[model samples]
Target: MGAPRILVVDDNKDMAQGVAMVLREAPAEVESAYTADEACARLGERAFDLVVTDVRMPGQDGMQLLDVIVERWPRSKVVMLTAYGTVQSAVEAMKRGACDYVTKPFNNEELLLVVKRALRERQLEEDLQRLQAEFEGRYVFEGLVGRDAQMLGVFDAVRKVAPSHATVLVCGEHGTGKELVARAIHRLSGRKGPFVAFSAAALPDTLIDAELFGARKGAFTGADHDRKGHFVEANDGTLFIDEVGSMPPLVQVKLLRVLQEREVLPVGSSTPTKTDARVVAATNTDLLRATREGRFRDDLYYRLSVVRVALPPLRDRIEDVPLLAEHFLSRRCSERGIAKKRLSHRATRVLLLHEWPGNVRELMNVIDRAVLFCQDDVVEPKHISFDEEATAADLSEPQSYEATKREVLERFQRLFVERLLHECDGNITEAARRAGLTRAAVHRMLKRLGIAAPHPEARRG
Candidate 1:
């Protein structure tokens, strides 16, 4: 296509020419219209990428023309330039589908920036519409879930950053949903590139360089063909490096160079290739600590630490457990065409009370397990399982009034014999003296209570 065509509309010839000149300096060609009437005529002559119109033109003002543009060319971006700043007029212009409003005395750069951004958004929306039609809902951008205050804050941040070319660094503990956050960023970002992911731990130490930076054919053994690694393949999209903290030293150096230089020097290659993909890295380990300990490079940590977003662990945000649980349950149940299930009130209480060491991933696993084993539409407290012994025991075998009394009386007799034995090492006379009983009485109590000499290594947990 030729240079993007922009229509500049105003009643004053000088003002219209000034607006046209401003747009002409951009990566676009400008056509001037003295009035809204002329703008309508120009629209019929040829299509334009954007329309910069003064809001208060005579006869038919910018608002009336904007409605016409919306009715006829809904894809076109229209920005209203008003000399008089009226809240009512601006609001009405916005309601009528004006992309942006700029008052008189606006700087040229400000106007240009607004116009360029509006055009970019229009193009992005058009591309997204086309992609949605082409894909036919074959993909899933719906798995991410959160409703807590912090999560809402994260959502707002993601939305704002996704459309930009900024590099995002996700920091959190293991299984705190970093990948999900990355995916959300990808879906919200308007780039049409592929999403690629790689685990640092899964690659052999010797192959980290080639796996990330690609390798020429015959560069080494098992190299049958030239290759494109995650960086090249994810151009114009996202490159998600998970467990980035575990990246080997050599690879860390190279990755840092790529991030800083925006170019990749593949293994065995003389020339470096330019890459345009946005990098989003996630790590579970304390990178700062690793840097201090020399396990991770300090320079690399700071380079990748731009725009850091720390995710809260499930244990820290227990209030969201039920929301996440229900989200997972509905998703899993839908996948299998089963009736959706909800955790009972009591079961939800149990879930909230337990510590979630594994974070959102752990919550998903529990919900999956519950959905698999549960037959009814509601999951009960007994149906839930906690891998931790203390939490599990509390739910599985709660203390009853009678059971507590019986255990207390039995524990008194058992401890009396055990204490004596510990003091005497099972000598009958010494044990009886400590227990305040005869040798036969001490032996009988020990036999009745089934108490034995305690083993030091028996209770490791």
Candidate 2:
């Protein structure tokens, strides 16, 4: 909560003092060291939030100092001060883990801006780590595991809204754990009745109504006896409706009435039964667009979205991959009653590098599969397998610096574009807006990389 503690290192005492003075304006606890050895001693004595060092220090220069900091205090961020001609060296420092760099005779505003950004990022990372440490058990909030800023926000929202009877709408891509969140809310709702779930997309149009709102004997072609619908069965409890965007027009009308009147009229029955079931609807598609296209009712959409919760995709929160992967691996091993399996360093690196298009669900599946396939206790690169697409790079072999850089950049571009399209649901304009790129530029890049959008509509635009 207080100003960040900073350490300024330079062999020249005057230069170190001058830089320290400028940083002190931010009201930080600034300390100076005249040599790398002195700086290392100070770091050992106590932790500093940020370390600013001149690139050309006598006896163990900035690069060496960076290495020591990275190995000894990985959490602390570093900023390099470079002479004009050594900009490349500063960039090298960044590649090695420095947060940022500024040239000598720096502008105070620019320096402060970089420092603020680095500090903010570090704070977010630390907060996420704390959350993860606290929620290491499988159930952070009813069998959900996440430590990213976005997921933490989702957890907070669920906690704040669980006690209320407000209709909730959970929105995310497929396999992003919308149902899990719904379950968490229900568990926290203090409702004694059973939790019931129905998927709108999995049922036939003719059966949708009958299944949702009970059917009396002989109501339809094969109705043998009276049946209780989700609304009636979940009375005094919670009802989760999955893939609500796919509900039929008639069903939408009936559901809207249920949300409004809190009652259901079973098929072949004139009498309506009062129900106190709390409704939670989930969708992977955009209900607003569905309404615009006349596929869904606008009033129903608004009624369901009283408290909307949007879950982040895996790509957006790559930082949580390691934690989730380890949890899955350990759980699977325990279920099998086998010795614990662990990922090799190489395997961990590969897992971190790949883009998880299928989200947390896909990552879990991969970990389980890897554990099963590995002959030894250690899950190596060979044991791991991804989807049919050859998106993962072959890290078994070494490559030139240029080749590795090019490959990494291309993969990142492809993944970023794919996620953008998915988030926008094939709407090119929306994707462009979110990506801050013109439509033509994205199209050109996609074409050049031979990357196709998952939604065909994006390709057309």
Candidate 3:
């Protein structure tokens, strides 16, 4: 909330003070430590937002200090300082949990830039943690995690509407967690009956009526025994009807009658049976458009959407990707009975850059696969593999010529730059040289492509 506290640790008193002085130019409280032990002592007294430490100290080196800080004060971010020859050690320090690194002969501007970036990152991390705590305490809705304004509004809506008997309509793209929202509403509704879910799209038109409104024995070809429909099965509770837009016209009429009369007319029976199910319907299609087009009944649409909850796609809330990734990683690791693993900073950047057309479900699957394949305690960029086919399929959808051209060019540029970097072993300067461009040009290109460059030391041509 106030000026960030920073600790500069170096065995050389002059180097430590000089680093501290440079950092003091920013709006930060800076202190100097001549040894790792003294740095630990300062940390014990109070937490510092960021620690800038030399890689090769006298007694306990920066790497050891990094381990201590990571284990004890997990919130504090560390930046390693190394000479040009010792850049590898700095890279290793990053793998061990340091936020960033700087070479010893770095310029004042460079040091200040790195320190400022580290401080900003620390602040963002703190903000995310605070939000997570707040959501967990107030909402306490399991399996839902987000800091986006739209998602927060959805949480608020669910909390306010859960105690009511009104039907809820949840609309979102496929894999956007529409069902999760439905389940959350059901959980908080304080109903005594079990939650029952049925998907209209999962069944054929012939069986939809039987599934939703019970079928008597000998009523249909496969009706060997009398069956209770979803309405009766979910009596006094919530019935989640997924892909509600896929319901047939006749079924829609029947569903409306059941909603209006609180009863279902089973097939092959003249008498209607009373039911008391609370309906929570979900759809990925535009039901309003369907109503206008005469494909979906307008009356049914109005009846189902007494309380509407719209979920934003993952791309709309890219800022929450890191938090969601971490959540999936932790859960996946626990399920596999393995030690907890974390995503590397570069890997996190890669995820943030992704256009998750598949939304939250896709992200969960990606994290699950990454955790299963990652060999070490950290998941790096190499371990993350996006669904290229899915992305390609998305690009193939109908669009304007200019939109298609722009998307193709962007994809080509990203692929070309990535291959160039790979050929040069992640050296941006060499990659730039091969592409007949300046290093700064290549840097800008990488930024535009949402590609995270290699370590700073790796970029020095």
Candidate 4:
């Protein structure tokens, strides 16, 4: 690899040269520019491996320069330097497509590390793009983040199925990012058709049939016109059915026949539709158990599991929380103007320690909420708002059977009330109604658990 040429842009010549000196000390070539104009000028002359720019500058500020650099010289990596309390500008720089940002007076080691990593990422992206262009749509996949053994097994399965015609069966708990895996398969497959998706759990049994098998005009009312079902629409492409375990028995039978017969029989239509679609089915329920219990068809399970892929839950790959959090934070901060922020190591540790029952989806929501309301650039532990009850339940570990039983029951009751109240918007009467209890009873449980109605909307009847 050649030397990493870094362009340090600052209004002050001294500050710019100082940044350049830091980079020169490292195993990289360094250049200094006193203004954004000079930086762009250098970019036009020769492509530096990376660009380090100041946030506040005289004319044509660093952010504007960042936009130009990313647009015209996207291959050049950028690092933004901003003073304390000016994280908003740094975030804007990232949003405009800077690789990363550094706070003013950053530790020398931290700044060097961020630059090296960002350049490495850019190099990898460029390499991937080059290979993809040469190979004609072969994708290695992204989004499924984990280094756990279980997840590696899943990744291997994806690799085998991506280039083949095999349908994939992804089984995992809810919010484990099953769809992300399905999309990865589709991307790698390069089937050249639309990737159609639907959730079996989101639709009622009656509509599930029509949605998957299409419906002719006036097919039992509300079928005003001929419509293409997901299977037909996804022909030559991948059809992702989420919560496939929730699919009604009748629909499952029809879906199975489609898989076996390579065709679909639309509702209220005598003719069959050719099923040239790649099917990717995912479910949270234990399909094997369901099969033995006669709730799920064994034959269907066999077909789907021809390529079974299991995703690791968030708790399983807790080591990846910081990476995931930082990814979310960067995109979110850039989009929402929440100011650039990184999680304090302690806060990051707390996040990793919690058992993420809701998995990746839940983690993203929590991080987004924290970033949304964060008052400072660094996300501290306090901003990481989590359910005390949930954390307590996950933390209160193994003990004697009797004590465990007691704690389990207590946690359940607490979570149950909390969920009901949350669902009813903290309205005690509505929560009581949902729980089949009296308002007084709900109030007592809330009092015992120290749960307070934080919002007035939640208190409405």
Measured by TM-score, the strongest candidate is 4
State every prediction's TM-score relative to the real structure: 0.55, 0.60, 0.58, 0.61
Query: How many residue pairs clash per model?
Result: 0, 0, 0, 2
Model 4 lDDT, residue 325, Cα = 79
Off by over 4 Å in 2: 1-139, 397-461
What lDDT is reached at residue 134 by model 2? Answer: 72
lDDT of 4 by residue, 1-461 (tens): 68778888999998888778878766788888888889889999998888888878889988889889888998888888888536676566767898888887888899889988987887798788787465332222366665555666777788789889887899888888899999989988989888999999868776899999898988877888988899999999999999888888999999899989989988899999897899999988899999999999999999888888888776656556666778778778999865679987556655765678888888888898888778888986668877443453343233443454444446657777877777866777778788789888877877888888546753543
On a 0 to 100 scale, what is the lDDT of residue 139 in model 3?
A: 41
Model 1: per-residue lDDT, tens digit, 1-461? 46778999999899889888888877788989988888998898889889999888889988899999999877778999988978998898888898899999899999989988987887788788888555433222335566666666666777787887777878888888788888888888988998998888877765778878888988888888888877999989899999998888889989989988988988889999888878889988888899999999998888877668888787655557776787688789999998888877667766766668888887888888889889998998767776664452244545443453344446545655666666666566777776578878876777788865344354222
> Which runs of model 3 end up more than 4 angstroms from their true locations?
1-135, 138-140, 389-461
lDDT against the true structure, each candidate: 0.79, 0.86, 0.86, 0.80
Instruction: List runs of model 4 lying over 4 Å from the truth.
Output: 1-43, 48-141, 387-390, 393-461
Order of candidate numbers by TM-score, starting with the best:
4, 2, 3, 1
Best by lDDT: 3
**Model 1: residue 330 alpha-carbon error in angstroms:** 1.4
Residue-by-residue lDDT tens digits, candidate 2, 1-461? 77889999999889889888888887789999988999999999999999998888778998999999999999899998878537677668888999998887878888888888888888899898888667664235577777877888899899899999999999999889999999999999999988999999977876889888888999998889899998999999999999999998999999999999999999999999999999999999999999999999999999999999999888777667777888889889999999988877667766766778899999988898898899798988788888754546678675553454456567667777877777877777788888788988878887888976456654566
Candidate 2 positional error at 182, Å: 0.6
Report the error of model 1 at residue 154, Å.
1.8
Sum up the clashes in candidate 1: 0
What's the residue-level lDDT of 384 in candidate 2? Answer: 82
